[model samples]
Target: MLSDPSRKYRPFPQVNLPDRQWPSRTITQAPRWLSTDLRDGNQALIDPMGAEKKQRFFDLLVKVGIKEIEVGFPSAGATEFDFISGLVRTGRVPDDVMVQVLTQSRKDLIDTSFESLRGARAAIVHLYNAVSPAWRQIVFNMTMPEIKQIAIEGAKLLRDNAAAQPDTDWHFEYSPETFSTAELDFSLEVCSAVMDILKPTPDHPIIFNLPATVEAAMPNIYADQIEYFGRNIPNRDSVIISLHTHNDRGTGVAATELGLLAGADRVEGCLFGNGERTGNVDLVTVALNMYTQGLSPGLDFSDIDEVIKTVEYCNQLPVHPRHPYAGELVFTAFSGSHQDAIKKGFAAQAQRNDELWQVPYLPIDPADLGQSYEAVIRVNSQSGKGGVAWVLEQDHGLKLPKKMQANFSSTVQELSDSTGRELTSTDIWESFEKRYHLKGDGRFRLIDFQESQSPKQQDERIFAGKIRIDGVEQSVSGRGNGLISSLANALESALGGQLDIIDYSEHAIGHGTDARAAAYVECRVGDGPVLFGVGISRDVATASVRAILSAANGA
Candidate 1:
C-alpha cells in the first residue's frame, strides 16, 4: 500500500448538475431487465458454459420470467455463432422473449451477428465501441470524430441489414462502451449520430446502453451523469436508456439503481453478479431490493434454491454464503440476540391481521423464496435461553416455562462449550430428556397410584400410591388439601425430607384423542438447588405425579 496514494491517483470528477432530479426521485416500478449470462458472464468464467449448459441456462432464465437475454457475441468464433444459430434453427426461442447478440463496428462481424439470428421472430442487434478519452488516446489512438464515425457507420450497417431482413422483428441497441468515464457531451453526440442513421420512432425505439465498463466514481455521480444525458439527448422518446455497470468499485448495483431513478429504462447484468474483474451488477440483488420496497420486480425467484443450483452449475462458481437474498446462510441466525429477536418477530408476524412482513435482522421472508423456518434459529454456544426454547418448540412442540428455559439453557451451553461445535435439534432434545429424567430408570419409580375425596372433610383428599425405591416396593399414604399437595405429602413422608413445589406447568402436546399431556415441575429438596423435571403421558394427573418423582430423583 502506498503511504501517499493521492500522489498517484486522482479523485473522479462529479457531474455538474445541481438541479439533479434523481436525488429526490424514488424507484416506483421495475425496469426492463436483460440477462447477459451467456455473453459477458460466460466470457469472464474460467470454464465457460458448453452447449448443454448454455441451453439449460437459457431455459432457466426463461422460467424465471426474463424476457430479454444477450445470447452471445456471434462474431467471436464458431462455437458462439453456432449456439446463437441453434436457438434460432431449432425454434427454441419463445414468441415473447427476444434473443440479443453482440458485435463490433466492423461490417463483417455485423453480418455474422445478423446471420446467427437469421430466422428468429424477434432479436436485438447490440453494437458497441469505446468512446472514452483514455480509450481514444491510449487504446485506439483516435480522436473524438473518429470514434463518433465508427458508431455512425455501425448504425448504418444495422439499418441496412434490418431493411433486407424485413420478416424478422429487429431492435437496435448502441452502446458507447466506456460511457461512465467518457465526456458526457461526446457520448451524447455519438448516440445522437447513431439515432439519426437508425431513424428510430417512439414505437421502434433505439436502445442507447450506457455501460460503466469500469466503475470509477460514487453511485450518486453516476446518477448525475444519467440524468444529464436524459435531459440533453435528442429524441428522448425514441431512445431507451439502458445501464450496464461493472463492479469495479463494488458499487455496480448501487449505480444501476441510481441510474434507474435518473430515468434510465433498462438494466443488463448476470444472475449473481458474474462477469469480468470484480463482476457485473447483480440483477438478483437489484430486483429483490425492489420486491422488499413493496414493488413487484417483475421476475420470479420463488424457487431461489433451484436458481442458485442452476447458476452455480452453469457458471462453475459458487455463490458467496453471504450473497444478498439467495445465499444459504442469509436466513440463518446463530447469534443469541439476533435469534431471540427473530423468534419474537415470528410470533408477532403470525398474530398480525395485515399482510405486511416485519422481522428483525431479516429484510425479507425466507418462506417467500421457498425456504423453511427450521433453519432460521439454530443452537450454538453463542445461543441464549430464548434461542434454545425456540428450537425445542419448533422441533419438538415443547414450550418450556420462562425460568425453565433459562435452567435448561445452561445445560445446553455446557455441552456446546465442551463439544466446541454447534448442536442440532436432536442433540438438544436428547439432552432435554436426560436432564429431566424422562428416559430410562430413576431413583424412585411409581408402580401404581390412586386418590379419593375425604367424607368428613370435603376439601381434604386421601392419596395412596405404591412405589419402588431402589428395587424395593412399599406403600405410601398421606392427606392434603389437593391431589398435587397430597402426592407431595406422601413423597416427603416416605423420602424423609421436606419437598417444596416452587413451580408447575402443563400443556397438551398434540391434538384430539392421540394427544398427550406434558408436565414440568421445579422442586427444592431440603437445602439443595432447585431442579426441573418433565413428564409426558395420556393422563394429566399421572404426568404431574411422574414430574414430581422426576424432580425427586434429581435431588
Candidate 2:
C-alpha cells in the first residue's frame, strides 16, 4: 500500500455547504422593474447601437410590456440627445410609457436632460451626484457640507425644471452616488435635503435611489445601510426608496434582495448586467428572481430570448452562457451527472401526472420566456438516457418511452463526442428528427402543386395540386376559394380518399428578401390530428401538399 505511486484523490472545486445561504425572500414584488437596457445597457457597449437600433430596441421593450424604460441620458452625449430627439419628433413614444432621462445634479446637464423631454407625455428626471467620503475627496474634492450644498442645489434645479413642464407630468428621482460606500448619516442628510427642496407630493412621489457604485463591502453591510435609511428616512410614506447595485462583489442579486428586504422599492439595471466597471445589477436575473417566486415584476418579460436579442443588439454585448435566466445555457445541462439526474427527474415527473413536479432539471421553463422547449435538455458528452428522452419529450412533443431512451442517449453521446461543441435547442431538435423520425423514409411523397387567388371567393382562394405517393403520379385538382381549402381538396383527390384538415399555418421562414417561404399543416387520421411538415420552395402549392404528405407518411 505504501509503494503505490498514484493515490485516490478528488480535487477540482467544491462549494462549501456552510457558506451557501439561499435568501429567504427572493424578490420584492412591490417594486417597479425599470429597465435601463436602452441607456445603461447601451453605455456598456463597445459598439453602442445608434438611434435606429435604439428605437428598435425601444419598440421591443414596449412590446414586452416594460412600463418604465430608462430611454436615455440625454445630458451625457450627442448621440443620446439625437435619440431623444428622434423619439420626440416622430411622436413614436406611447402615452402610458414613461420616458426616463438621467442627468447629474450639475446645471448644464440638468438643463439638457429637461430639454430632451420637452414634448414627452410623462417623464422622470433622475438627478444624481457623488456624495461618499472617498468620492468627495478624490472626485469632487469637496467636504460633506459642500456635497450637501450640491445636492440641495441639484434638487432645486430638478424642481424648477419639473415645474417649468407644468403641462407635462414629471416625477423627480434623486440618486446619492456611491451610496453603499458613503457614510449612512451623510447619505441620509443629502437625500433628505433633496426631498425637502423638491417637496414631493403624494400624487408624484419622490424617489431616492441609493447606488452601490463602488462596492467596498459585503452584502450585509449594504443591507444594513438600506435598513438604516428605510427606518430613518423622513416622509418615506410620501416617497419611494430605490436601489441600484453593481456586481463588484459578485453579489449584486444578493445585495438587491437584501436591500429590498430592508425596504427599497424600485430597481434599475440592464438586462444581463451591462454597465460601468463590473456592471450594474442584472435586471433579468433580479426581475426573474421575483417572477419565479410567484411575484409579478409589473413587466411581462416572459420571452427571454427576444429580450436577450434586444439587449445584445443594443449593447453590442454577448451574454455569458452561465448567466441566470437569459444566458444561452442557463437552462441547459451538459454535465454527465447533471444530464443523467435531469433525465431521471423528468421520467419520474412524467410517471406521476397526478402530481405536478416542478423538478430541479430546469429552474424555469424556457417556454415562459417565449423560448421553445426544444433546447431545455440537450445532449452532450455529459448527457445520458434521461437527458435525451427529455429533449425528445420537450422539443418534439414526442414522449420517449423509457425503453427507447438508451438508444437515443447513445446517439447523443456519439454526436457530442463528434462535435466538441454544445448543441443548442434548435440544433438538437433538427438532428433528432432527422435521425429517428418515421417521415424521413415514408410511404407518401409530394411531387408538385400550385395555387392562384383573386381574394374574391368565399372561403376559397383557388388552389390546385399534384403528388407522386408510392411513385404513382396522382394528378388532382380543386376550386376552393381559399388556399387551405383548395389544398385540402387537392390532397383528398390525390390520396384517392379524404382526410380531415385539422390545422394549417403559413409564415415567413426568416427576415428580408433572402427569407425562404414555409408552410405547415395538420391532418387527422382515424382519431387525433398530427402536425404536417413542409420545406422551403418557390412553389407555394407544392409546399402545402408536401406538408400534408409529411403527416400522412407518419412524420
Q: Which candidate achieves the best lDDT against the true structure?
A: 1
> Which ten contiguous residues of candidate 1 have the minimum total lDDT?
375-384
Q: Write the per-residue lDDT of candidate 2 for residues 31-143, one digit (tens) a residue.
A: 87677878877777766777656876788878867778888889778999988877876788888788898888789999999888897788888888888777899888998
- Candidate 1 has an lDDT of 0.88
Query: Candidate 1 — which residues are off by over 4 angstroms?
Result: 376-555
Q: Residue-wise lDDT of candidate 1 within 112-172, one digit each (tens)?
A: 9999999889999999999999999999999999999999999999999998999999999
The TM-score of candidate 2 is 0.65
lDDT of each: 0.88, 0.70
The TM-score leader among the candidates is 1
Question: For model 1, which pairs clash?
Answer: none
- Candidate 2 residue runs with Cα over 4 Å from true position: 1-30, 351-356, 372-538, 541-555
Clashes of 2: 9
